[model samples]
Target: MLKFFPEEIEFKVPQVMKTTKWIKSISESNGYKLGELNYILCSDDYLLEVNKQYLDHDYYTDIITFDNSEEEDKLEGDVFVSVDRVRDNAESLNVPFETEFRRVLIHGLLHLMGYEDSTDELKLQMRAKEDECLMLF
Candidate 1:
């Protein structure tokens, strides 16, 4: 199951059915099954608090994913997205808000799939995969 909630914000994912279907397709195509995935949209401040409390990192980030899957081939996680950061990133990157927002959405999913961005090579690979998945959107 896939769900989206706005935390301390008044936002809705643009296309609920289409977006959910696309996300599931991405997971299945990547050899993983979609489990209980939740997306929480909130302000940067709200996410910053979560970062501090959960991650012990006192900084702002676009997305923070908590993978809670018990099976190897299934994905279950809570993906936290900062709407404020997404809007700012869209403006700074000269892309539409929707585009950047979708990127962030898939970025979290990719992370749940075991993709990492701790190094330049890994970051490049992650970006390429994100672009490929974005094209499917």
Candidate 2:
């Protein structure tokens, strides 16, 4: 299951059903079944607080995912996204807002899929996989 929530923000997620289907395909294609996933869209300040309160990091990030997987065969997590950061990143990256937003959304899913970006090599792999997943949508 996937749920979307807005926290101190008014952003609306486009094509909910289509996006859910795409997320499921991403999970299944990666050899894991989809589980509960929550997307909390919020302002950058809210996300920064979450970063500090939950992750002990005092920085602004596009998305922060909390893994809640209980089974080896399933993917479950809460993905908190900063709409403010997304918009800024879109403008900085010179891409459409939806495009960058979707990428960040899937980037959280990728984290739930046991993908990491702690190193340069892992970041490269993650980006490549993100591109491939985006092509599917």
TM-score between model 2 and native? 0.97
Model 2 misses residue 101 by how many Å? Answer: 0.7
Score candidate 1 by TM-score against the native: 0.98
How many times do residue backbones clash in model 2?
0
Number of residue pairs clashing in candidate 1, backbone atoms closer than 3 angstroms, sequence gap of 3 or more or interchain: 0
Cα error, residue 50 of model 2, in Å, equals 0.4
Candidate 2 local lDDT, 1-137, one digit each (tens)? 88899989887888778888998898898899888989999999999999999999999999999999999989888999999999999999999998888899999999988889999999999999999999999
Over 15-85, each residue of candidate 1 has an lDDT whose tens digit, in order, gives 77888898999999999999999999999999999999999999999999999999999999999999999
- Error at 85, model 2, angstroms: 0.4
Who wins the lDDT comparison?
1
**TM-score of every model versus the real structure:** 0.98, 0.97
Counted clashes in each candidate structure: 0, 0
